[model samples]
Target: MSAELRRELSRLDTLANALDSQFRIPGIGMRIGWDGILGLVPGVGDAVTLLPAAYLLYKGHRLGARRMTLMQMALNSGIDLAIGAVPLLGDLFDIGFKANKRNVALLRRDIEARIEEVA
Candidate 1:
């Protein structure tokens, strides 16, 4: 991968990790991130969280991800947004789903495959 792509991926990875799993729950062995914290709000929170996820999807597309990979990323984000629309349970679900992380993994895999193909 090019340096720019590597940097962008690293940045997105950091952002996604922060949003999805930044903190640990000490005794319970659970973790939560900004997404979960923001999910405390009703409508606005979910909407706000969707922005970053959408941006990641856009970035994935720009990086030349395959249609299927893009679709999978969209599905992950869609599920996160859909179920995350619920009030309390959705917030809890967001804590565990980590859709952003999953999307990043998908993006990385796609990038790696492309690199291998080029090689």
Candidate 2:
């Protein structure tokens, strides 16, 4: 991958991870971000949070992240969004569940695994 692409993906991962961090989970809260406040507004916060994943999924598809891999990432987003739509449950789930973070991890792992295969 080119330096620019790496930087872009890194930034996206940071943002996604931040969204996942608003919770108090151990080993996860370090990435906490403003999703709590921003997400208070209806329709916008969730949309903002999901956008990065959508972009990443599109990019991943273009970059040839396998169909199943891409589906898993998409499924993560779907689950997050679905659960996040609930009243109190969504908020709690948002803080506890780090779908974006998980997706980033998945992507990174895929990258690493491919690299290993080459070696």
Candidate 3:
């Protein structure tokens, strides 16, 4: 696939978490949310987050992301899955943590580092 397409896929990879919570709270633009609600759906909630993450991994591979970076992505998803599988703890975990946001952050940081290396 083309680089642009990979980039777009990467963008989509972060959406599962997006639907779970409003990155920034509505109207006021606050950066908190009711993300814990997604955890109630059990399998689907976690799957919702996983699919996008997998897309990210696939696109990241296509884009030549380092093995370490890909591993980091896997770790991120694993943690998300682990934390999201519990009962009340999982809901609280989702509310407090945004793994998808963090993964996207990782990808952006990786891209910047790669650019610096090229320069």
The best candidate by TM-score is 1
lDDT of each: 0.92, 0.71, 0.67
lDDT of 2: 0.71
Estimate the TM-score for candidate 3: 0.72
lDDT of 3 by residue, 19-114 (tens): 445566569654533334556787677666577668767866776778898899889778877888887788667766677666666776777688
Clash pairs for candidate 1: none
Of 2 and 3, which scores higher on lDDT?
A: 2
Q: For residues 1-119, could you state the per-residue lDDT of candidate 1 as single tens digits?
A: 89999999999899999999899979998889888888888889889999999999999999999999999999999999899999888988998899999999999999999999999
Candidate order, lDDT descending:
1, 2, 3
Q: Which stretches of candidate 1 lie over 4 Å from their true place?
A: none
Poorest stretch of ten by lDDT in candidate 1: 30-39
1 or 3, greater by TM-score: 1
lDDT of 2 by residue, 26-103 (tens): 775444455544556577777777777687788777665667788899998898777777767676676667777777
